[model samples]
Target: MAADRGARLGFGLAASVLAADVATKAAIVAWVEYGARHEWLPILNIVHVLNRGAAFSFLHDAGGWQRFFFIAIALAASVFLAILMRRPGSSQPERMAFGLILGGALANMFDRIGRGAVVDWIDFHWGAHHWPAFNVADIGITVGAALIVFHELFGRRRVSEVNG
Candidate 1:
């Protein structure tokens, strides 16, 4: 019963993340002109940009093979996360984290397959220094990773206490 509930929660969250990522990316593509930037706040900007590489545009200039490479990696990661979410004895938080990571990976993979690049629009900047633009999927992945780290460091103790 617990496993079923965990699976439901994890899958539901994954679907939500995927939907938001897709919708936001589509809206940005439809409404914003490519390469155009609009200031939304002192520290934020809305822009239409595509990333051809991994996080921080790593290897963005590495010709074209990186697209397929990244797609492969995303597929493998998504599969692994799905398996983790379904594993017996997994905690709710762990399931949720896996779901987030899976959703983000799948979202980015879809972008790579359909558009040949991932859409990145949210940009934060201060003076001349600017953070790389990213989308909803990146948020899911980043948060999920942090959650997993936090759980590993602190949450395991609580679980041990309850189960021991």
Candidate 2:
């Protein structure tokens, strides 16, 4: 990020990701019966399952305290992301990365607050092995994290070298 360029704003992309994530979750909850599983394809499934814990249902079976813990974490992370988004020297990709993270974090936080768990419905599997279910928020977070990593590796290095 050049001094003149400052930080790129990415509220629109973040908002769109949030909207799409919430909309899809709403549709899934409204139409799909809880615990229902549909094999959309040989390798994919559309199911309605509540995840009480983090990725892959870790700590899902814990009594119930994990809920508050996760909420706190997401809330803190969102605040930090907002700060990063406002930094003057942040680049476009960096801003987008933060935006995507913010959207997904808030979306999942909504679920954790409302339902005590996140709604996960996308499942991938082979004959006997099945991947854990995930949703749009998860996708956004995954991609956003990747983007941040990309910027840290190639983007920032190239910029520094060019300037020097």
Candidate 3:
């Protein structure tokens, strides 16, 4: 029963996040030309950029094999996350966290396969310093990871109060 609930929660969150991420990417690409920026806030802008590599453009200069490498990694992680989500007795929060990460990973993998690169548009900068521009998919993954960490640090303590 718990497994079923977790599976449903996981799939639902994953699908919703994937849809939002894809839709936003499409809209951004349609409205903004590549490498162009539109400042929406003093510290934020929307810029269309293609990242052909991993985080921070790691391996971006490597011939072309990095694409396949990342694809395989995403594929494996998606499978593992799905398995974890459906594991018997898993909590809803755990499943939801996996869902978000799964959605983001799959979304980026789709970009890697279809566009040959991920489309990123959100940009944040501080005066002379700039942070990597990422998309909604990245947010999903980051937030999901943070939730998992929070569960580990605090959520489990609450659970222990009930079980232990």
Please provide, for model 3 over 36-80, each residue's C-alpha lDDT reduced to its tens digit, 9 standing for 90 to 100: 998899999999999989888888888889999999999999999
| Better-scoring candidate (TM-score), 1 or 3 | 1
TM-score for each of the candidates: 0.97, 0.92, 0.96
How do all the candidates rank in terms of lDDT, highest first? 1, 3, 2
TM-score of 1: 0.97
What do the candidate models score in CA lDDT, each in turn? Answer: 0.94, 0.87, 0.91
Better candidate number, 2 or 3, judged by TM-score: 3
1-164 per-residue lDDT for model 2 (tens digits): 45224333455567777898899999999999999999899999999999999888999999899999999999999999878887876788888888888888989999999999999989999998998999998988888999999999899999989999
RMSD of each: 0.9, 2.2, 1.0
Instruction: Rank the models by TM-score, top first.
Output: 1, 3, 2
lDDT of 3: 0.91
Better candidate by TM-score, 1 or 2 = 1
lDDT of 2: 0.87
lDDT of 1 at 25: 96
